[model samples]
Target: MDKIDKQILAILQEDASTPVAEIAEKVNLSSTPCWRRIQKLEEDGVILRRVALLDADKLNVGVTVFVSIKTNQHNANWYSQFSNTVKLIPEVVEFYRMSGNIDYLLRVVVPNIAAYDAVYQKLTQSNALFDVNASFAMEQIKHTTALPLDYAGLN
Candidate 1:
């Protein structure tokens, strides 16, 4: 990708709904070229699916919980089963395999403590975990889906 592609990405990351003409104007290109660039970005997988950001408080799922999981079973079959079980829980919005003492981490969102407990119960019932720890966030200081484009080394 070139500088124009990076500029397009930076703009789209802020608001995918921005008009092609506006993007072209900002990037000093014609509308057709800007539109084609966006299409190319999509076809090349540089630009994934666009989505609307939702307000958790308004949705009644304000509470955020980070769960750290350490498992005794590290085999492929065990991981497959664990991943499948985790995927079934709607509250688990993010899941990651960590490099530190924690084997896996999950970010869960719920309405309240009781709702979180229900999700916790579901997670444990499906698979056996060696150790599970959960930490609740009192406040969300910053949350964003936008990625930094400077890291791409575009001029």
Candidate 2:
């Protein structure tokens, strides 16, 4: 990838619906070449599927909760079952296995505290957890899907 490719990515990150001609003009390339670059980026898996950003408040799911989980069971079978259970839950937007004291971290969004409690109850019933902690987010200062292009090296 080169500087132009990085520029193209940055522009697409801002708005994936940006027309090829518009992106091409910004990157100082013709439409064909710019389109080709985008195709190559997709083929290389650098360009993942584009999606729309939705407003949580407008959807009435403004509550954000960070859930930290600790498990005594560290085997593959336990992990597989727990992962599957979490995957089936719509409120769990993001889930990750961590390298710290917590075994897993989940970012959940819901309409209210009662909804979160229901999710928590479901999780506890599905599996045996050593500990489960949830922290509610009071405010969101910054939120963006755009990643930095500086580390792309070519940029």
Candidate 2 least-lDDT 10 residues? 146-155
lDDT of each: 0.93, 0.96
How much is the lDDT of residue 100 in candidate 2? 85
lDDT (Cα, tens digit) per residue for candidate 2, span 1-155: 78999999999999999999999999999999999999999999999899999999999999999999999999999999999999999999999999989999999999999999999999999999999999999999999999998887553
lDDT of 1 at 21: 99
Model 2, position 21: C-alpha lDDT score = 99
lDDT leader: 2
**Candidate 1 off by > 4 Å:** 153-155
Model 2 scores a C-alpha lDDT of: 0.96
Off by over 4 Å in 2: 153-155
